[model samples]
Target: MSSAQPEDGLPVRRVITADSFRALKFKLSGARPAAAPADPVSLPQPPAPQVLPQERPVLAVPVEPPAEPETVAHEPPAPLDVPEEEPPAELIVENAVAAMPEAAEPAEAEPPAEAARPEPAPEPVPETAPVVAPEPPRVEAQSSVPNAGTTAASSPSAGFIERRVVERPQPEDPEAGKRAHALLDIMAMPTVGSLPQERALANDTLLRLIPRMPLKSLRHLAERVCVMESPSQLLVRRLINDSRIEVSGPLLEQAMTVDDSDLIAVAASNNPAKLKLMARRRIISPALSEALIRSNHVETLLNLLRNPGAAFSIESMWRLTRIAAGHPVLQAPLVTRHDTPSPIAFQLFWQLPSELRRYVLSRFLTDSETISKILTMNAESDGAPRKHADHSLLSELEVTAPGEAGAIYAELAHVGRETGDRIAEDQGGEALTVALKAAGLTRAQFGAIADKRADAEALKAIFDTLSFNKARVLLTYWDWAARRTGPYARIAAA
Candidate 1:
């Protein structure tokens, strides 16, 4: 130990151990003394914070204060000392990077490398590329004439043309029959599952061949074609008026393709057989019946009357009755028609056979006596003169011969009857008037004489000469008689 002097000039003496000297030296150097190790059991722990009754304290204690946590100024961590490895031979580059000057300023503007090196010119593109479109379907060109399958040199019956594709006939080809047969064979080919195009092709081929086919072959073809489910209208129409009955018969009977106009044309033609076939069709229009009536073909008209499917206008029925009146065969069928008009039925009643007449009477409520009276009236009224009678003379005769008038009329009527001269029975208008006036005949008496005399005109003349009241009574009776007879009778009476 050594004594030391204080700055106040006071001498101080102190004894120092080695430990104290080491501690002093460390203190001056600002170094803390290392703490000695303590026993684990002896180490004092801090007091625990207060815990709420409801909460349990966790085992992990927080290291920092929540309110103002202690933040240590941390120094950056030292870089890891990783061992360096030698560069691979492939990664080594021949050109070394040039060292930049430490004090060098960056250049204000650098020229673009793209401007220095000219850009490669764009490659030219062709304007059009090869585009493939689907090809249109090929339809074989047809010749003007349709007999291409046959030739002038070929025989008419060219043995069944196995593979004949009849497109269109050339004008030079004369064997039209052979071409028709070939086209028919193609159409007859089993079309059960054939494509629409194939059926259409066959149809087009047949249509073209039809006009070119000879008459005989066309007729035979028509018979077969008419039986098809749906035959072409054009083909059926062409065959409908064919001059030969064989050709037109099947078409008229079976073809639905024949329009009413075509049927009418056929009916109008001078072919009874064709018209007869038309009458036998499944259905007939009123227009067709009229056309057949105009044809005046008895057999055709008869057939039309018999066909249950035939429709007739009132006019047509009347015309049929008029024509049928002379035909015994037509009368039976016309009477059987349920649609026969009442007037026509009455007209037919007179012509029908006894058995059919009973049938007609059963259908209508016509009075036979009334009809007879009408006939009598019509027979009398026809061609009767309209000469005015001397009404003044009638009055004078009534005054002079009132009692003898009845006897005179009876004698005159008897004499006229014996001579078989209706004109004598009628006498003159003046004489008939005078007799009627002198007799002062009642309506019933006048009607009986008029009907018996068969002279309605004479009755009219007598009526004209009578007094207005007497004439009215007679006129009413005559009107009733006319109504019972017929429409014409009624008009005449009026």
Candidate 2:
């Protein structure tokens, strides 16, 4: 090693090879060598710092991503097929012969290379398998699924499907059963691998493996997992977070029945991780929430009209509708708008009695257009759709001392929406026709809808059939009044 301070007062150090050290041994004595400079460079400012752009960040405008460093070459990994050790040719030939005795026998006259060739040709045996098997249908999918043996044709009939549940005897030796179960559990798990739909089979295998399984196995636990879904989600967080998660399905249903917002909020909280956990895991479906909301909705009156026998209550609707009133996801449900209740809502409100209807209508029906529409509809169409009611039930029930009447056109039409009490659809018209028909009220009994729709002349005749007093009021006074009020005033009167 040679180190020295030269003319510029710069110290430099040199490491010499063994040859150079031996040659310099005679000239240099045992004096202490000078220390190398902290930073050695040809130029005083340093050799441009090797211009490593990576070490120093760019001083320009900040961009989304910084520039990358230059890449250094790397060696590729060795091929996987390459074995750690190569067998001797003789040993390989010996093994090859042993593996394919038939092939070796066939080509015994030639070198083993020819025999190896014949052996490898057997790879095409799979393709030629059909010719050998003679019955392709009997061996379908044998190559891929590898002997499933299960077949649609061989499947047992309805008798097998109708078999009742049966119990099996448990192993008497509990310890032996436990070990067997544990061993079988490991083996079966590898095949099933936590697949979504393999649960039943996996559970069956699990029970079989643990021969000491309870008579009902995990049936109760399984049923609870599926059925005890939370309705409120408020208690769900607390319940699932606890070490002992014991709760009934009906209770969970009650909990989940609340608004989704409350559910999401409760789930978001740390204390109630269960709801959030279920949401994350997707165990609770979106459809379930939607169905629950729908179940609570008002349901269009038309549907009720079509199927009068189908009576559905909307009790839970209050909480669900109030909470999810503004959520866009709740649009499909027949819930009234949060800001402006819909026509059906108004109808429901109006059904609350004269005083309540008047108050609600006055408070919320502030929109003149809406009010005008409602009032006009109340006059022209009454309650029934314009078209259907005008022809079918409208004229018959229109004069029913106000409240006793069936749906009438004048009750629901308004503004430019002269849709009348007309059925929005012919099916609705057909439904009304069917109902009237089913009621056994014919054209003669209820009068033709056309007769009801007729000008003053036809309606006058209908008045003639009923009591003179009621008919007179309906005929002359009602007719004159309907005309005098400009149709709008008649609804106001009602």
Candidate 3:
């Protein structure tokens, strides 16, 4: 290597020689040197660096290759080819590189020309590509529900319906049952009144609970609510339609909350007993009367006729009179009803027994012209089928009066005997006269049967005043009134 001092007082460098360049390549490759040559080859040495008195002498410390780490079961690395005191050949090579001129830097040999790589054949492009809809991303959703089958989040199969298991009704809880009973009791308390909303809610709850309540509980509830000053209409309607009479009777017979529309609906049923209870309502609308009459229930019709509070339309009375033409027991009340139109009463006059006919003419018909027309119609209808006599009257007595049937018969058998006294004692003068006349006895026999002087006078006057036909009508009227006021009224009606 050669050097010069520049104007900047820095050492200038010259080209490195071939031998130094050869040594650098060998040092970098970490190759062992060949054996020394037979003749020593001398090489030019570099000039020493100058140092001032204030500067310390600079030493050219050699860089040794890094020691390969010791590894287990591995041959020890070949001993380094370096002396500890002498500078390493690699260090001299590095100094040579640092001093070399840029122009004299050895050129890297061009790599042997890579076998000419042929240009990749351009990829063929199709002239036209089919347009396809992009597929929707699939989401694999894991169902948290146990035993549930996985379903695709994308398009579901057409016509596929997903079904879940329907839960079964659970057995009623004891606590829930107790709560229901408590609610019923609370609502039933007379002193307690509910707001409309509360009452409506309570009615809905009760309707749900009704099918579960026993007949006794239902009947008791019916009794309680029927008498309430303001009862739930929904509750009243449900109870009135109950299958059991005991559960429904009070509501049908006495519940003020029961509407005429409700009664009309109930009258549509085939249940004659229900109709009878409905017949006994304090007031009945014309529509309901028509419905009851349409029932053609003989007993129900009788009760309706006996109910003075019941109003009958003209058409209803006309229909009822036609029906009464066949049911002899219906004639008395139908003809006597104040609401019975004069025309309807006149039409029914021919069908009634002699006693009821007399009662109808005396009470229902004051018009002389109407009376003459009724008599003419009666003569004309004589050729028509007569209304059947009520054989059920005695049967009804046996059923309604029970043990009293034999006494009634015995009183008719032996006049002025123990039977007559028993009759007078049990029933009053009016009753004895009715019984005698109804039994086809004369006014004289009724007098003989009368054991009390006051009864005999009053009853004789009654006997003289009322014809036999009218007495029989009174008899039927009294019988019905008794039965209505009796314990077996409902049974008889049923």
What Cα-based lDDT does every candidate model obtain?
A: 0.53, 0.32, 0.56
Model 3 regions more than 4 Å off: 1-181, 185-200, 364-494
- Encode model 1's per-residue lDDT on 363-475: one tens digit a residue: 54323455545544543574432233333332343455545443444343221222112222433333344345433555655564556455566555445445533322222
Best by lDDT: 3
lDDT by residue (tens digit), candidate 3, 237-296:
777877788988888898877788888888898698898988899988888888888888
TM-score of each: 0.38, 0.22, 0.39
What's the CA RMSD for each of the models? 30.9, 27.6, 29.3
What value does the lDDT take at residue 280 in candidate 3?
94
**Collision count of model 3:** 2
Poorest 10 consecutive residues of model 1 by lDDT?
A: 89-98
Q: In model 2, which runs have C-alpha deviations exceeding 4 angstroms?
A: 1-133, 139-286, 293-340, 368-494
lDDT of 3 at 197: 62
Ranking by TM-score: 3, 1, 2
* Residue 283 in candidate 3, Cα distance off native in Å: 1.1
